[model samples]
Target chain A: MGVVVPLEDDRGRGQNAVAQLQALVAKEMQAVNEFIRERMASDVPMVPELASHLINSGGKRLRPMLTIAASRLCGYNGTDHIKLAATVEFLHTATLLHDDVVDESDMRRGAKTARMLWGNQASVLVGDFLLGRAFKLMVETKSLRALEIIADAASVIAEGEVMQLAAAKDTGTTEDAYLRVIQAKTAALFAAATEIGAVISEKNGSEAAALESYGRNLGIAFQLVDDALDYGGRAASLGKNVGDDFREGKITLPVVLAFRRGNAEERAFWERTLQQGDRQEGDLEHAVDLMNKHAALEDTILRARHYGAIANDALAIFPDSPYRQALTDLVDFCINRNH
Target chain B: MGVVVPLEDDRGRGQNAVAQLQALVAKEMQAVNEFIRERMASDVPMVPELASHLINSGGKRLRPMLTIAASRLCGYNGTDHIKLAATVEFLHTATLLHDDVVDESDMRRGAKTARMLWGNQASVLVGDFLLGRAFKLMVETKSLRALEIIADAASVIAEGEVMQLAAAKDTGTTEDAYLRVIQAKTAALFAAATEIGAVISEKNGSEAAALESYGRNLGIAFQLVDDALDYGGRAASLGKNVGDDFREGKITLPVVLAFRRGNAEERAFWERTLQQGDRQEGDLEHAVDLMNKHAALEDTILRARHYGAIANDALAIFPDSPYRQALTDLVDFCINRNH
Candidate 1:
C-alpha cells in the first residue's frame, strides 16, 4: 500500500479520513493504478518515464478516489468503474502535465516537475499520449454517457487554461472571472470524475446532479483554499514555495479581492507588481500585507468554507455510511489541510 | 468555395487530382467543413482564431476527402461519414498544431504557423482542444470500433513523434528508423481515416483492409516525396526555405541513403553538419551536392513510386468510379509533385 502521510497534528482526522477512503475503494483504486501503469508503458521510454514520474510522485490519487467513492456511494457493483476511474486520473494527469508547461512551474507535489526534468516537448507529447489512452479506455468501457462527460470536461479544461492565460497578471480580473477559471481549470474534471461515477453506476438524474454539485463545490473549495494558502506563508507546506502565484503574476482569489478593495495607492501597487510584473524584493511581503489589510486571505478561506458547506449539504440526499462520511470528511480536509 | 491553389508552372495533374477528389465528394466535404467550423468555435476566442488561422490557411483537406471518398467507394449512404471526415481532419489538424510546435517551424502552407502568431502554449492547448472535440465527434458516431481505431492511431502518432525526436539529428539513423517515423507520424492517420470510412459503410474485412493498405501506402508515398522535395531545390516551392530539414538536422530517408553511400570524408561531413548541427556557409548547397552525387533524392522518389504502385494495386479490388479514378490519380500526384 502507498504511504499516507497526514499532517503533523489535527487529531488525525485527515489521516483517518484518507485511510477510510482508501479502505473503502482500495481494490478499485488498485485496479486504476495498475491500469495507469500498464497503459503508460510505451516503446518510447520518455513517454512512460515522464508519465510515471508525475503520477507516482506522491499525489493522493484523490480525483480517482472521488470517482470510486461516488460510484460506490451510488451503489455501483460493476467492473467499469475501474476503467472510468483510470480514465479520470488519466485526464487529470494529462492536464497537470500541460499546466506545468503553461504555468512554467518548477515543482509539483514537493518534487521537481516533469518539465523540469524532461523539458516542455516531452511533457506536451506525453500528456497527449495519456489523453489518447484515456479516450481508448473510455472506448473500452463502451459507455457513451461516460465518454461524453469526460470529453466535455477535457474541452472545458483547455478553454479554461486559455482563459486563465489570458487573464493572468491582470489585476482587473473580477471574482466572477476567477471563479470561472477555477471552475474550468480544477472543478470541471472533479465534477466529471464524480458524475461519471454516478453515470456508470446507472444512477438517476437527481443522484448524478447531486454528485456533480458535490464535486463542483468541493473543487471550488479546494482551489480557494489553495489560493489562500499561496500567500498565507504556508506555501512550503503545500509542496510549493509561497508567493509563486505572486511571482507568476497569477491573480487568484486573494489578489482579486485585495485589488478590488484596496485604495488607489494599493491599486497602483497591484498594477506595478502584478499587471506589469515589475516585482521587486519584499513585494511578496507587501502584497501579503495588503491582503491582510483587506482580510483577503481570511475572506478567501471563508469563501472556501461556504463552498465546502454546500458540498457537504449536497451529499445529504444519500444514505449515511462510512463511504459517505469519508467523503464528507474529505471536504473538511480540503478546507483545513496545511500540506 | 475555399481556394485550391496548385503550385504555379506545374503540369496540372496534382490540381486535377485534387479537383476530381473535391468533385467526387463536394456535398459531403462541405458538410465536413461546416462541422469543423462549428465544432472549433469556443467562448475563448483564441481557440477559434488560431484554429481557423491554420484550418482555413489553404490546406487541401486531403485527409477528410479521403474519408469521404473511402466511404463513398464502399457505397456508404449514411451521414456518419461526415462526422468521421471531420474527426479525421481534426485529428490531422491537431497533429499539425503540435508538429509545428515540436518542429519549431515558423511557416506552413505558405503562411506563418499558428505558433508564429500565437505562442507554443496556445498551439499545444488548442491542439488539445481539437483532440477533445475530435473524440467528442467520434463518440457521437456511436461506433466503438471507429473510436478504437482512431484512438489507437492517436497514441501511435504521439509515439511516432517521440521516436522522431529521439532519432532527430542522428546521422547514424537507419532507413528503417526513418520509415518507422513517417509511418507513425503520417500513415497511421491515413490508414485510420480510410479504414473508418470502410468500417462505417459496413464494408467487409477485405475491403476495409484494402482501403487501409491503400491509405497507408499513399501516405508513405506522400511523405517520401516531401522528404525528397526538401533537398531537391524545391523547398521554397513547398513554402519553406531550402535546407530547412537539413538545418533542423532531421534524419530523413535522403540523409540516411546519402550517409550510407558517402565516402569516409563525406561521412565526416555528415557527422559535422547533421549530428553536430555545426553547419557553415554553403553547407546546404554542399549537402545537396552530396545528395545528388549519391542519387539519394532520386532514390527517395523511386521509393515513393514503389509505394505508389502498391497503393494503386491495393485499390484495384474496388470497382470503377470517378472516386476510384481520382484516388488512383492521387497516388501519381503524391509521387510526382514538387510541392
Candidate 2:
C-alpha cells in the first residue's frame, strides 16, 4: 500500500481515478510489489537500499498499474503477467537512477535521490543490475514477442535520453523535436507495458495494437501535464520544487513555444538563461510570467487534452468493464492532476 | 582491420597465439565488426562518435573472439553466432564506458576515453544505449537458455562492480574476496560468451560447462596478469599509465599480497597510500619496491599460471583442431603477456 502519487489533496476525482485503478488490481499489484522487493535484494546492501529509497518513496506506480490493468482487461489469467509487471517497474526504476545521475538532480519524490545518498557509482551499477534483473524476468516469461517489445522499448528509452541530453539547454529546440523526445523517453515504455499485456493474453492482433496506442497516448499526455506542472506555480506543493525545469535550464514545451513566440528581447532572455546557463534569482518567476502572457502553459495542457482524448478512444474497442473504466479514468487523472 | 591488442614489439609466441586465435575467426569477426558498426549508428551524432571512439580504439576483442572461436569449436555452422558475437562486444564496450566513468579514467587503449572526450553524462547514456542495443541483439537469437545465460552474466557483472566499489580501498580485503570480485566483474562475461557459443551449437551439455570453465579461468588469469602488469614497471609502454591502479588507490592482488606479507612499517605504508589515499611522489615506486621485495608480483603471476593451467585442461575433452590449439595458446598468451 504505497501512497499513490502523494498529491497534497487526496479528495477529488483525480485521486479517485488512481485509487480505483489500483484497487481493481490490488492482488496482482501485491505480487508485483513482492516480486520487486525480493528481486531487489542482493548481498550488496546498497543495491537494496538505493532501490528501496526510490521505489518505496511515493511513486504513482502508474506504469505497473497500467501493466496489470491492461493485462486483466485483455483477460490474462496466468502468473507470467506478474513477472512482466514487476519487470516494467524495474525498468522504470533503473532509468530513474541513471536519469538522476545524468541530470545531477538532488531531490526526487520529495526524498533525496539514490545518487545523492549512495554516490553516483552505486547508482549507475545498481541501475545496471536492476536492468539485467528486468531482462532476466522478461526472459523467464518465455514469451519472445513480449520480450522483444520490452527490449525495443528499452532501446528507445535510451535513445530518447541521449537525444534529450543532446538538446539540453538548447533553446532553439522545436516543438516537434520535443514531442519526439517525450515519445521516446516516456511513452515507449508505457506503450510496451500495455502492449505486453495484450501479448501475454494471446490477444496479439488488434487488442495489442489498441492497448499500445492507449499507453502511448496516455504517456504523451502524462508527460505534457508533468512539463506544464513545472510552471503551474504548484511545484512546491508537489514533491519536486516548482520551476525545476527553469533552474536546470530544461527547455520544455512551454519554453519552446515561448521562445519561438517571444520578441527579440524575450528571445535574448531565453538564449541567455537557457543556452548560456546564466540563471539568476527571479528568472523563474519572469519565465513563468512570460509563459502566462503567451498562454503557453494553457496550450500545453490543451495538447495533453488532445492526446488524452485519443487515449480514451483507444479503450473504446473493449467492452465496458471495471478494468476498462479504471484505465479510462487513469487518462483523466493524468491530464487533470495538479501535481 | 582493427589491431588486436597492439602490444609493443609484436613478435614471438604470445603475438602468434592471439593472431592464431583471431585468424581462425577472422571472417566471423569481420561480420561481427560490421554488425557493431551498423547497429551503433544513430541519428544522434554523439552516439556513433562515442561508440566509435571506444570500439575502434584497438581493443583485444577477446570476448567476442571467444564467442566465435568456441562456437566454431563446437562445430556450429550457423550465423546466429555473428549477432551473438557482436552482442558480446557491445556488452564489453558498454561496461568499459561505464567503468571509465566510474574510475574517472582519462586514458584507454592509448587513446582518450569516451568519458574524457565527451562528458561523463554522454558516456553514461551512451553506455546505456549500447547495453539496450546488446539486449535487442541477444533476443533476436530466440534461444531462451542463451538469453538467460547472458542476462545472468550481465547481472553478476554489475554485482561484481558494486562489490569492487565496496572493496576499492580496503586493504583488509582478503584474497578470497578479491577473487570473487574479479570473478563477477571480469570473468562472468568471458564465461557467458564461451558458454553461449557451445549453447548456440546445441552443445549445452558437458561442452557448455567445459567452455564456461575455460573462459572463467582464462578471464581470471587474464586479470591477474593485468593487475601485475600495472605494477610490473611496463606501465609506460602500455596505453594506460603504469601505477594507475596505485594512483587511484586501487588495491589489486599485488597490493593485497604485499600488504598481507608486510612488516609493521610497510603495513603502515600500505594503509597510508591505499587506505587513506594519501600518496606522496615516491608512493608508487615505493609500493612497487615493496611488492618486489615480498615477491608479490611474481606470486601473482604464479597464481595466474595456476588458473591458466586449468583453462588449458578444460579443453581436453574437445578433439584436436586448429580452434582448440588456438584457444589453448590463448591461455598461455594471457598468463605470459607483459602488456
Candidate 3:
C-alpha cells in the first residue's frame, strides 16, 4: 500500500495555510483594532494620541494571532477569543512602550519610538493605561484561568526585563542567563497567549500543557531567529538596521555563542567591542565576521530549528487539522525566515 | 440634656479613636512590609535589589494608612485589609519608581532614587514588576469590585501623569487641566485606598459612595497642601526641598493661580521662570515672593481647607465611633500637614 501524503500539489498545503492564516489574522486584527480604539479613547485627547501612535504603528500583532489561532484550534467558537486576543495585544503594546522608555530607544520599526515622539512621561503613563485596559478586558471575559495566565505572564515579562537590564553589556552574562531573560520577556507572553485559549475553552490538563509547551518552544525559536537576523539580515528586509543590538551593547545569543567558541585573539576582539562599549568604523562588520568564523550564528540557527521542531511535535496531541498544519508552518517560518 | 464631652484620660470616643487608628495603621504597616519584601524578592537577584531599594526607602506610607483606616471604619475584620493596604503601597511605590525614571530625578525623600542607584532600566522594569505584583495581590483578594476600583484608579493615575507631561511648561495649561491631572494622578489612588475597604467590607451603596467622596476630597486637600509647600515651605518642615517643583518646571496649583492673578510685570516674572523653563539664581525666591504677593498660596490653602471639611462631612453617615474621629483628624492632617 502506498502512503498517502497530505501535500501533492506545489500550491496545495503552503498556499492554503497562508490563506487561512491571513484570513484568521485579518479578522482578529480588526477586532483588536476596534477594541484598542474604543478602550484608548478617553475624555482627554492625549490619551488617544499616545495610545494610537503605538498601537497603529505597524506592530505585526503576532501575540494576538497566537491567541486567536490557539482558541480556534481548541475548537472554541465564541467571541471571547476576540477579547482575549485584544488583551494579548494590549499587554504586548504596553511592554513595548515601557521598554522603549527604559531603554531610551529613539527608533522602532524605522520610526521614532512613542517615548521619543511623545515623551518618556507619556510613554510610561500610556503603558500603564494599556496594562489596566488589558485587565479590564480580562475581567469582562469572566475566566479566572485567563486572568491567572495573564497575571503570571505579566510578572514573568517584568522579571525578564529586569534580567535583561542587569545583563546588558555585561561580559559575565551566561547562556543560561540569556535563556532565562528570553523566557521571561518574550516566551512567557507567547505561552500565555496559547495556554489561555485552552484554559478558557476547557481543554483537559494534558492538552493545555501541550499547547503551552508548544508556545514556549515556538517563542524561544522566534526570539532566537530574531537575534540572528540582527547580525546578518539586511536592514531593509528586517525593517531595522543591522548591528542595532550590538550598538545597544545587548549580548544576545549570537554574541554569547561567539564568545563561548572564540579563540584567544577572537576573545580579545569580543572584549574590545562588547566590554569597552566602543565600536569604531567597521566594528559591526568585524563582529559579524568573527561570529561567522566561530560558526556561532549557524549553531544558534540550528538550536532555533531544534526548538521549532519540538514546538511542532508538541501539537501531535491535536488531531490532524488545517489549523495544526498552519501552526507547524508558523514554527518553520519562525526558524527559516531571513528577517 | 448636657452634651457629655468625654475627658481626654477617659479613653472615650476621642481617645479610643486615636488608639484604634494607630493600632490599625501599625498592623497594616507590618503586613505591608512583609508583602513588599516577599513580592520584591525574585529568582532574579537584581529585581529584588532594585525593588527593595525603592520599597525600603523612607516613604510616608500615607496611602496604605488610608486604606487600613478606611477599612477599619467600614467595619472590616478580615485580613483582606492587610492585602489591600499592601496593594495601595505597592501601587504608590510603583508610580514613584516610574516617576523617578521619567523625571530623571536623582533624589527622592532625601536619598538616591531607585533609578539613580540602579539605572533607569532597572527602575522602569522593577516598577513594572511592582505594578504587576499589586494586581496579583488584588486578584488574590477575590473581590471583582476591588479589582475594578483599583484598576480604574491605576489607569487614571497614568492618565494624570500623561496630562502633567503634556502641560508641563506649557502656558496654555489651565486650572481645570491641573485639577483633572491631580484628580487622575493623586486623588484617584486616594479614593481607591479609602473606598476599597468599604468595597471589601460589603458596605451599602451609600456608605461606599461616602467613603469614595471622603477619599477624593482628602486627596485633593493633601495635594493642595503639597503644592503650597513646594512654593515656600521650609525643607525642615516639608521633608522635601522647597522650589523643587519650580526647578522641575512643574506648573502646580499655586503657580497656576499666581499666573492667573498676576499683573503684566508679575506675569513676565512667571513666564521667565515657568513658561520659558529658565531659572536664574534667586528665581525660586522670586517665584515664592510673587506667589505670596498674588495671594496664590493663601488661596490654595483655603481651597485645601474647604476640601478637608468636605472629607469630614463624608463621615456623618457612619456610626459615631472613635475610629470615625481619627478619620476626621486625618483630614485635618492632610490639609494642615507641612511634610
Candidate 4:
C-alpha cells in the first residue's frame, strides 16, 4: 500500500524492467507472438508482405506483455488473456502503420517504415487489415466488456492523433493540451490493454480501475520520456535521429515548456523554426540549447516521474507477487528509460 | 419467383428499386441518417470535415436501406437494426475514403474526393477514425454474431483490396480471379449488411444464410454491371469519366473477357496499353471498339443477369411481401441499370 521503491532509487536496479517482464511472461508472450504471425498471414500477397514488414520489425511487445502480466496478477488462469494480448498488439501495430503514413515518417524500430517500403495506400489498407483482425480477436473472446474497452480506446486514440495533428508545429500549444494528446493517443491503449486483462480475469471494479490507472499513468510517463528523448537521449538506442521531432515541428512537452518560458527573441526563434518549419543547419542544436537554457528536458523527466509514482501506487492494492512486482518495476522503467 | 418478371422487363414498374426500399424504411432510414450525421460529428474539426465530405455527398444510402429492409423483412420491430445499419454505412464510408486514397482518385459520385481536397494523410486518419467509430457501434449492439460477421467482413474487404491492387494493370488477370476480387471487396459488405438484419431478428440459420446468399449475389451483380457500364454506358450518367477502368488498367470482367477472346493483334494492344500502362490519345476509344468487337460488355451484363437470377431464386423461400418483392426487383435493377 506504499511506494515499493522510491522513484529516486531506480538506479540501484540496472536490470531492464521491460526485459524482466518479457521473461516473466515468456510463455504467454510466445503464444501471442505466434498468434500474431499466424493471423497476419492472408491469401492476398501484398497484405502479408506489407503487414509483416511492420510486424517483424523490432517492436518490444511491451503492451501485450502488460496485458498478460495484469491477468496473471489477478490470479486468473485461462487462455482468454492470450487472445486479448494479441488483440492489443494488433491494435498497437495497426496504429503504428497508420501513424507512419500520417507523420510521413520514413523510419521506425530502426527500419524503413511500411509506408516507405510500400506506398501510403498500402500502409493505410494493411493497417486496416490489422485493425479488422484485432476486432475479430476481441469478438472471439466473447467478453463484451473487453470489446467495449478496446473499441473505445480505438476511437480515443484516433481522436488524439487528430488533435495532435491540429496541435503540431504550434508554439502556442499548452502543456495541458500536450498531456491530453499523449493520454488519448498513447495512454488510452495502454489503459485498455491492461484494463482488459482485469476484465477478462473477472476482477472486481476497484481492482480493474486500479489496473487501468496503473496503465494510464505508465503510458503517459512512457510517452513523456519518449518525447524528452527525441532531444536529449542517445540516438543509437532510439533508432531515430536526435531532434527528429524538432525537425518535424512536433509540439511536445519540452518545446511547450521552453516556448512558455522563453523571452521575445527565443519566442521568435521557435515561431520561425517550429511554427514555420524553416529549419537550417544547427537549428536542431540551437533548439536543444534553448531546452537546456530553460531546463525543459529535466522538468519533463520530473513530470514523468510524478506519473510513474502514481502508476506504482496503483499496483499497491494487489498482493505482493512476481507479476505485481514486475508491473511495479515497469513504471520505473517507463520513467527512466530513454527509448 | 419465376425470374421475377425477367431482368429485361424491369421497365414495367417505373419505380426505382432503391427508391421503393427507401420509402419502405423511411422511418428507420431517417434514424440511420440522423445517427450517421451525429456520429460523424466529432470534436476533431478535420474528422467531420473529411467524413461529411463523403457521407453527405449524395450517397443513395442503399446499403443501410438494405439493412433496414432486411430486418423489416424478418418481421422484427426493434431499434438494433438502426444501429447495425449505421455500422454498415460507417464501414462502407470508411472503406470508400481509404479506397479513394488507394486508387489516387480525384472524383467520386461527381464530387472531389477527401484525399483530393485535404491530402492523403487526412483521408487515412479520418478513415481510421470512422472505422474505429464503426467498431464502437457494432460493440454497442452487444451481438457477438453481428460483431463476428462485420469484423470478418472488414478483414475480407481489406484482403480483397490488396488482391485488387495485385490484380491491377495486369492483363493476365483471369475472370475467376476478378470475380474473387469483387466478391471479397464488394459483396462481402453487402452480405454482412443483409445478413446482420436477419441475425439481430433471431432468424434461424437457414433463413440467415438465405438472406446472405441473396445479398452476396445481388452485390456481385451490382459490381459486375457497374464494371460493364464503365465501358458501354454513357459517361454523363456515371458521375465519373468514361473509360476510368480502362485508364486505370483495372482488369475487371470486361477487360478479362476481352483479353481471353482477342486475336493476337488485339492481345498485343491490350498488353501494350494495359500491362505496360502506355496509353495513347485514342486508346480508350480503341479499347471500347475491341470490347464491342468481342461483345465483352454485353457478356459481362449477361453474367450479371445470371447472378441476378440466382439472387431472385434465393428469395423464393420468403413469403410474398412488399420487402421481398422490392429485394427481388433490386436484383433486376442491379443488372439493368447503367449507373
Candidate 3, residues B104-208, lDDT tens digits: the string is 787887788887778887887887888888888888888778877887888888888877887888755788888888988899999999999899899849878
Per-model TM-score, in order, reads 0.94, 0.95, 0.92, 0.94
lDDT of each: 0.86, 0.87, 0.79, 0.85
lDDT of 4 by residue, A1-339 (tens): 111222346643424667788889998888998998898889888998888887777778889999999999998799989999999999998999999888989888778898888788778888888999999999999999999899889888988998898889789998998999999999999999999989999995988999999999999999988888888642212233577798788999989999999999999999999899888998888887888789888788889989989998999999899898889888777776655
lDDT of 2 by residue, A175-211 (tens): 9999999999999999999999999999999999999
True lDDT of residue A10, candidate 1: 45
Error of 4 at A107 (Å): 1.1
Q: Which structure is stronger by DockQ: 1 or 2?
A: 1
**Residue A125 lDDT, candidate 2, scale 0-100:** 93
Instruction: Output DockQ, candidate 3.
Output: 0.62
Clash numbers, per candidate: 0, 0, 1, 0
Ranking according to lDDT, highest score first: 2, 1, 4, 3
Selected candidate, larger TM-score, 2 vs 3 = 2
Q: List the residue pairs that clash in candidate 2.
A: none
lDDT of 3: 0.79
- After superposing the true interface residues, what Cα RMSD does each candidate give? 0.8, 0.9, 1.2, 1.1
lDDT of 1 by residue, A152-186 (tens): 89988999989988899788999999999999989
**What DockQ does each listed candidate score?**
0.75, 0.72, 0.62, 0.70
Q: How close is candidate 1 to the true structure, as a TM-score?
A: 0.94
CAPRI quality level assigned to candidate 3 from its DockQ score: medium
